[model samples]
Target: MTAVRVAVIGCGSIAKHRHLIEYDLQPGVEITAVCDIVEERAKAAAEKYGATAYTDYETLLKEEEVDAVSVCLPNYLHAPVSIAALEAGCHVLCEKPMATSREEAQQMIDAANKNEKKLMIAHNQRFVPSHQKARELIEQGEIGKIYSFRTAFGHGGPEGWSVDGKDSWFFQKEKAFIGAMGDLGVHKADLMRYLLGEEFTEVAGFVESSAKEGSDVDDNAVCILKSASGVVGTLAASWAYSAKEDNSTVIYGEKATLRLEDDPNFSLVAQYVSGEVVKYELGGIQTNDAGGQTTSKVIHHFITSITENTTPPIDGEDGKKSLEVILNALESAETKRICG
Candidate 1:
């Protein structure tokens, strides 16, 4: 097997927990470089993953041997870094909420197309066994016709999770752009789109900073979506929940309803119209410590697409669709009106 040389562009929590660690586990992939503005963080990741370290991403991109790069930077830098890597002849696996705006996301897609490289987004929830099962059932007509759904992802706060606590770029409007919506809501929106196999046509939302004092970004948000197929649903995300919930999605169909919760266990429960409830315990979707399970799967798909000259399951266009949904949600909140 020819190993693909991979470089990580950020040493943040997601990079450390998902990108680097998962790539380390893959037999046909090698973590060749780690980059971060903080030299110490990059060096630590390099030492941990047995890879080279660079404080600037440009240095890593210049390495001729690197076949791929993971853009794990803050929300704002996702598009710029991914475009640079793709233009440099490297496949890119970008983290979720692909970019702060639709235009930026489209630019990344355009660059990928121009370079003829695989570009994938890390919407890991789509790879979870339970979520896949839900998608399968929906596709197979087990749910009849999807009418509506609800999903959420919430956590205590960014204080402990982020390297810089309240001082983290996540709390800053300029660096992070939107708050919980970008941080967590985007996952639910993507999950809903994946399960229903539809694009959100409109969105209405409300955002607030209820928990933290002096926070510029939102700590909680709720958005309602209307899909192209006329399915109506609600998506909620927050960093203010007392207990952490990773990712949860519920789909209501004409014949039944399906529920998926990431923590506690990966279980799929369906309540039928006949009053017979079915439960499926899916232990196969388990992730190693650091939430790298889906990350690893996404990386594998990206590499396979490049190696085989095929399209990835969640390609650049897919990333743009998810980003559009979230961005529209933000616009809805700001104007107190539905947006597309």
Candidate 2:
């Protein structure tokens, strides 16, 4: 089979670190093109990867013969760019917080359906080894009757991660739409649903902008989530974790408790009612810190789904459902009432 030609729509930190690097590692994949509004960034990536570069995505889509494209643009551009790529006869792998609203996300999905193409969301937490192990243990009844849980994704803000630093679109309300809730909260929301195999029924939370000095978007948020199976838990997203990044989850159950990514050495640990403890040294998760670029397995998965003509693990509807949780959380925060 011929290698699947791919293009990256943004040359930001995510593109440089995850999408581009991972795509290069796949066996039957070729980097055909890259696009970015900033010409220099696109050119740099193109030169390094030996692909063409364009400042405008529409031009790149029209000119390149790519089988798939990674929509690594900002939160606001995900839907539109993905729809365009799908319409241009290319499968799309969009980044998280897939769109600004349900309508936009649905539009992207519709375009993919109409074009007979795949649409995958970049919710990499679901692919983490420890997270997958936790799900398997739960499925095997290792943690019986899950009652409650707490999951968090926090860092010291995106200034250190984004290419533009403080001036990146991440801190702007208009471009980012929502801040910590969209950036970090959505990942945990999707991960919790994947691990527990349940949908969120209701949410109530506090969203705040008290972290960064001159940012209009929220930097810290706390949400109370209730799952369909009567499992209640807390989900937190914050750019205020100044000391260290915390991407951890603890699930409480009737027979045992599961802790994931909560330790420096052990990536996962399960403690049982019988005074037995099992620890898993499954390596570390992907992080923004230097030398922390563990493979997310998202880009490779997207390529495989396209080559195999199968539905991606996190499809467009899955992205929409995860997005809905954050949307309802925002509503709950604003109205001071629970939202479903």
Candidate 3:
């Protein structure tokens, strides 16, 4: 097969660090175009990757003959931009929290279905090495019946990572819709779903904006999720961990407790009730810190799905289910009641 021509929309940190870099690394993938509302950022990325630059995504979609595009735009633009690309006959690899609302997420899925295009959500947590291994172990029944779990994705904040620093749209409720929950919480929500192979049926959460000054969206959130099979867990997302980033999950089962991304030396570890222990030295997760450009595998998977004419693992339906968990958490926060 010929190379899969690709464009990356929104040359922000995620696009610059993940999408463009990963696409350039993939074989049979060509970086054909780059788009950003900011012309300079778009030009810089396009020049670095030897691709055409456009300030408007619509124009890029109309002019460039691309097989796929990564929607790395802000939270608010995800749905519209993705739907536009799908309608324009391009497979889409959209950044997480696929849309601000469930209705918009459904519309994105509908557009993909109508156009017969692949629509994958960039929930990169599922692609992490230790995460993949843990899923395999669970599926193999290495850990008997999952009983409870606690997962967290927290860091100082996106101000240090986003292109705009403290002034990034991530702090704005209108642009971000929800702050830490949308940015960090959704990843854990999606990760738990993948690792456990179960849908979260109910959620109760306390989401707040206490951590970040002058921010309208939640900067700290704690949610309790009940899975379909009655497994319950705590999901915590925050921008207040000022010292070090914490992306960790511990799954308790009848046989053992599987810990992921928690230990410094081992990325994953399982301790049996019978006093046996197993440790995995899988590589580190991608972080906002310097020199943390671990490959997420999202772009490569998106390209392969397009070229192979196969459905993406984290397709629109999968993305919507994850988004639903966050949305229900938000509703639960506002109403002081459990939501689903």
Candidate 4:
């Protein structure tokens, strides 16, 4: 079988760290080209991977003979680039929150459907080994019926992560669409829905600009989510976890409470109401400002889906639904009412 030739759009920190490294980890993927507005970044990536480089994404789409592309651009450009790639007959793996809005997300999905190509959102949190184990335990009824849960994803803002530092597109409302809620909160919202196997029927949120001055985007958000199955919880995303990154969750169930990534030695802990406890030896979440590489299973699965001609686990529609939580949370915070 011919190897899947791939290109990367937007050679930023995510592209430089996660996408490029993960793509290299895959067996039958060839990095054919890279695109970025910054010639230096693109050239560096190209030199490292021995791939062609292009500044204009449209030109890359038209010129590169690739099987797929990773859309690692700003949140706003995700839909446009992905739709263009699908139209160009290449599968797309987009970084999340899939698009700026639900409508744009739908258009991306529609494009994938029209082209018969896979569109997988890079919501990497769900792929964490601890998270996977939690899902497995939930399905086996190890945690019993989940009654409530709380999940949060936060860090010291994208300045610590983005190559552009404080001036990155992540801090601008116009370019980022939404801030921490979209950047970090949407990730937990997606993970919440995934673990519980439920849709967030309604939500009320408090979105605020608590940090990161000189920008209009929000830096903190607290969202109250209710699943269709009567599960209630809080989902918080913030860029003001200046002390440390706080990506943690605890699911309360009839049998016990599962504390995930809540401990150093034990990544997961099951504390029964009866005073009995079980500590899982799984490694805790990546404990750093710069995320670790072991966490991103997105590329491997995306390439496998394309090579096997199967639907990706987190397809375009899944991305849209996860995005719905973020959008509705923004609405809920703005209107000060529960929104769907």
Candidate 5:
């Protein structure tokens, strides 16, 4: 397809800061349309990207003849918008926490399949350099027999980065589903699966909304995950990290333990039982910092997938697997019992 014609739905912070910007910069992609409920935001983005703007997504989906779309809307709207786009014959790149529940996620995959369209989820952690290096090391047997692990993603709060600040839809339970778990926890879920190359079989968790004030949704969440291979680990997601952000992952194995983003200088390190050590200088994980190194090669992959007529790296099935982990964690927290 010529330039992989694309449209971006939602002119929010992520749309403005990363998605659109990256699309504009990507070599084989073109920003064809921009849509948002807020007309002003849509107009602003349209002006910036030289793309037509629409206030309603329905009109945009019906009118615009784009090859693909980036569904950057809120959590609740993900499945619906993506389904519509897929049915409209457009490949979709939807943001993370694929949907509010497993059923919704399944419907999305079915829609994509029925329409013969591609669906990619924006799970950016898998594209991180350090995380990629660690995965390679583990796969190469640098970390012999993995036993357990701990991964966490936390920051001050979405209030600082969200388009609506403290009043963002993220604080609204109906709109966000489960705040930190959806926003941050799901990333770790996907990452752990990618790094360990296994699916989580069971999960137990504690989710809380005690961090930020005036928010009804959870700000803190921690889950214990057991993989199909009996590899257990702790995954944490939080908005109460006021001092600094902590997005770290560590894997313990018999031969050597691989640490990712654990030190000040070395972003990835492996320590062996034979007193051997390997330090890597790959960049650390991107946090909520606006000026930080945030964007990834995800856009390039998306465009390439569309042009080459291949399934994206982070496809709908992959997204659903990660979403299941987070959704199960929420259920485990509510029932105070282990969930599968």
Candidate 6:
């Protein structure tokens, strides 16, 4: 089988830790090129991964042998880069929080359609073993009717994790567009949508910058989401959690309640109405970078989708839906009213 020649558009943390390394592990995928605004970073990644390096994404896209591109840039750059990659005749696996706005997200969907290329969003949380188990129980009706949920993804500020520390683009609204909401909130939003298999109909939220100093964007956010199926839930995201929680979701149902906790591993606990609680101790779903393992699974799904001509697990529309939830949360915070 000819390997899928993949190019990575950004050499940032996510790209380095997840995409590049995961693709390297896939036997049928080859890292063909690496791109970053900083030449040295791109060159270093390319050298490490044994791929060509380029400073300009457009130049990297011009590589005739490239079959797919991973849009691993900052949140604001996702749509433009993915659209360009689709137009350039390569499939796209874009990092989450698809775009800063719904309109931009739609444009990406349109571009994917117009180019006849597959576009997948990297909503990796859905691929976690615990998350998948929860989804199975929910789908099998083992939990009975899911009436509500609570989900969150929190961590210490990006200062330490990012390559540039406090100078990282994550602290800048111009580059990141939003802080904790875009960074961690989007994951919970997407994960709930995936597990419940429902669309969010409306939202109300409160966002604040309580922890990180010298930042204009919100460092913490909490939102109420009402799904189309009449399920209601709360989602909380923060960069202020010193304990570093990655992502966790709890589902309440008529027959039972399910809890997922993130830390040493992804474990599931279910409490039935009979007053019996069952704990499932799931092993190492956490990758080197906390969520990187799931990210790898998401990439594998994208590759499978491309090869099989089937929809990716997290397609463009799936990606857009998650972004809409986050955007609505932001609007709700601003207007002090529910937003849809």
- Runs in model 1 deviating more than 4 A are 262-266, 284-296
| Model 2 pairs in collision | none
- lDDT at position 105, candidate 5: 95
Worst lDDT window (10 residues) for model 1? Answer: 285-294
lDDT scores for all predictions?
Answer: 0.84, 0.94, 0.93, 0.89, 0.91, 0.87
| Residue-level lDDT tens digits of model 1 in 268-338 | 88889999988888754434335434444776677788778898888889888888888888888889899
CA lDDT of 39 in candidate 5? 92
Worst 10 residues of 4 by lDDT: 286-295
Candidate 2, position 154, lDDT: 97
RMSD of 2: 0.7
Tens-place lDDT digits, model 3, residues 1-340: 7899999999999988888889989999999999998999999998999999999999999999999889998899999999999999999999989999999999999999999999999999999999999999999998899999999999999999999999999998889998999999999999999999989999999998899899999999999999999999999999999999999999999899999989999999999999999999999988778887458888878888887889998999999999999999999999999998
Evaluate model 2: give its lDDT: 0.94
Top-scoring candidate (lDDT) = 2
Please, what is the TM-score per model? 0.94, 0.99, 0.99, 0.98, 0.98, 0.95
Kindly list the per-residue Cα lDDT of model 6 for residues 3-87, writing each as its tens digit. 8999999998888888888899877998989999999999999899899999999877875468899998988999899998999
For each candidate, how many residue pairs have backbone atoms clashing (under 3 Å)? 0, 0, 0, 0, 0, 0
Would you give me the overall lDDT of model 4? Answer: 0.89
Model 2 agreement with the true structure over 227-290: per-residue lDDT tens digits: 9989999999999999999999999999999999998899999999999999999989989899
TM-score of 6: 0.95
What tens-digit string does per-residue lDDT give for candidate 5 at 1-340?
3678899999999888879989999887889999999999999999999999998889998998999999999999999999999999999999988999889999999999999999999999999999999889888987788999999999988889988997899999889887999999999999999999999999999999998787888899989999999999999999999898998899999898888988889999989999999998987566568578757777878888888888899999999999999888988999999999
Quote the lDDT for 2 in model 4: 89
- Residue range 207-230, candidate 4, lDDT tens digits: 999698898988998999999989
